[model samples]
Structure formats: C-alpha cells, structure tokens
Target: MANKFIIRWITLCIVLVVASIKPIEADSDRFNACFESCNEKCKNDDYGNAYCEVKCDFDCGAKEVSAKFNIAI
Candidate 1:
C-alpha cells in the first residue's frame, strides 16, 4: 500500500510538471510573435507615438501571456 501511494504521488507530480512546461513554452512563443508584429507595425507607420501605443498594447498581451505561462516578464 505504501509503495502504491508513492507511485501515485510520483505520477501526479510528473503529470503536473509536464502540464506546466507546455504553457510556458506556448506563452514564450506568443510573446515573441507579438513583439515581432509590434516592431513590424511600428516600422511601417513612421508614427512614433502611435507606434509606442500599439507596442504598449502588445506588451500588455505579452504580460498576460507570461502570467498564463507562470512566468515573470
């Protein structure tokens, strides 16, 4: 019974770890995409302030993505 409990606990830990890693990877991808898109848009517009504002909005989304991924950004 003790061995069974230990095995169950280890299995649970492994499952949790795997689940957590996936979201972090996904959020990193999302943040990178948003950063790239915002930079591209800013380059095209030639409007510094508007570019900054749009970039800020994208940054906010990136922040949320970090939170969802359990990361600090």
Candidate 2:
C-alpha cells in the first residue's frame, strides 16, 4: 500500500510537470520579443549593460501598467 501511494504521488508530479511546460513554450515568442526590445534599447545606453537592464525592466513594467489602465507611458 505504501509503495502504491508513492507511485501515485510520483505519477501525479510527472503529469503536473508535463502540463506546465506547454504554456511556457507557447509564451516563448512573446518573451523573445520583449527581450529583443529591451536589448536594442539598452545597447546604446551610456550607463552600460547592467544599469540598462534594470532600467529596461522598469520601463517595461511601467508600460505594462499604463497600458493596462489604458494610459500611455
């Protein structure tokens, strides 16, 4: 009985992992697009890569929030 319970738990974990991967795969294109936009804008920055990355994140977050509220950032 203990072995059967362990097997079921393992099976459930495996199924959950398989189910979760598909949505992340589907979102890869959008992720890549956002990364590319950040990369381009950050490339010419005077503060260098690290600072630009932080700035890009802030900019993206602000854009998303403003867009969510139907306002332009």
Model 2, span 29-51: residue lDDT tens: 55456766886778866568877
lDDT by residue for model 1 (1-73), tens: 9999999999999999988784334555666666667767776778686666677566868686678778987
Best by lDDT: 1
Candidate 2 matches the true fold with a TM-score of 0.44
Model 2 has a clash total of 0
Considering summed lDDT, which 10 consecutive residues are worst modelled in model 1?
A: 22-31
| Poorest lDDT segment (10 consecutive residues) of candidate 2 | 22-31
With a 3 Å backbone cut-off (N, CA, C), the pairs that clash in candidate 1 are: none
Q: What is the lDDT of residue 59 in candidate 1?
A: 83
> For model 1, what is the error of residue 39's alpha carbon versus the real structure, in angstroms, after optimal superposition?
1.1
Q: Give the C-alpha lDDT of model 2.
A: 0.70
Error of 2 at 23 (Å): 18
